[model samples]
Target: MPDDFAPTPTTLTTADGLSLEAQWAVPLKHRAKVVVAHPHPQHGGNMHSLVVSTLFAHLIGSDCAVLRFNFRGVGRSEGEHDFGEGEQLDVRAAVDSLAQSGDAQCPLVLAGWSFGADLALTCDAPELAGWFLVAPPLRVLGDERFKAAPDPRPKWLAIPERDQFNPPDQAQVAIADWTNAEIHPISGADHFLVGRTDKLNALIDSFLSAL
Candidate 1:
């Protein structure tokens, strides 16, 4: 990573008083601010997950401040995983961290992959301007826990055509009633999204550019 885009290690304190490990990169002139969440913790996901790290690098390169963090029990982050329940607070802490840093008026968006994507949908932070979800398994948490589906803010979903967890068609049906939500299917990509980071990054760039 270039010196200008190097991430600064930090810690985020969640509402439940747990300290989560995190890394934040701020560009010289940021166009927007973003908080990136990794996949499931039990599945070996953390701040350094491929998709999360790639998005962090791409966002900083595009002159956007970005933050990526490990969930409660993952990596060096404190506390145990409360399934998708306590994780919501972790996401909110990330959003709060970015909101308090600099340029409070800049667009703040949340981007997540797989398990993290499902978790993001459950967060209804007022500071979040929108969301960008990648292959979210809409069934991870029950529908009753989801709060973003009806939100009027713009939301973009990058669904994988062959996703083992949730294919494009299933994702479409899941979000059919969601307000201001748009889907962009990635051809031939699966749930893991191996070798598809570039496309995801491009989609994110376009999403931020339009904000």
Candidate 2:
């Protein structure tokens, strides 16, 4: 609730000409700028999702400027869902929004949850410094679509041990050949990560520190 952490509601324009609803917060000083994407829009995901909001709450401080937004069709935003296809543009718009709102010299990191995680893997913008994925199903699109797999940028995956969609073991096989990527398992956590937010946040903290 502090003044520096207060989020300012904003809007983003995607390349294809859609206005997306968003909110961003910048601290008095920051080392990194982050854009957070929520889970599947068709499945009730939005900028206020627990994990997405957690990242917003945890990251917007003296060290980071954070932005969380609803995908094209999720909230007050315009345009319909495009599965994982057009959503990529939505992510790009978010990155663009944050880039213009914060310190351009600071590292830009993409943090996403579930379906949003898969979207993060598909974004190959040159501005991205790193990525943090939480319990990504990895089945939303296809392996060929994950542009970040071969990318050398730092990536951290928080795979839930008992995830209904993609467990730690399956996740391991999926990222076997990925470059500069690491997986941190959330023991006893399912895909929803009911009570494992603390563990997840810890991993985020570590990721931010490393950057």
Off by over 4 Å in 2: none
Look at candidate 1 and tell me the lDDT of residue 11. 96
Q: Write the per-residue lDDT of candidate 2 for residues 1-211, one digit (tens) a residue.
A: 6787788998999999999999999877788898999999988999999889877887875478998889988889998999999999999999888887767788999989999999999998998999999999998999999999999999999998999998888888989999999989999899888888888878888898898
Candidate 2 has an lDDT of: 0.90
Task: List model 1 lDDT by residue over 1-211, tens digit each.
Answer: 6786788999999999999999998766678999999999888888898889888888888888999999999999999988899999999999899988867778999989998999999988999899999989988799888899999998999998889988888888888998999989988788888898899988998998888
Ten residues in sequence with the least summed lDDT for candidate 1? 1-10
Angstrom error at residue 205, model 1: 0.9
Give candidate 1 misplaced runs (Cα > 4 Å): 1-4
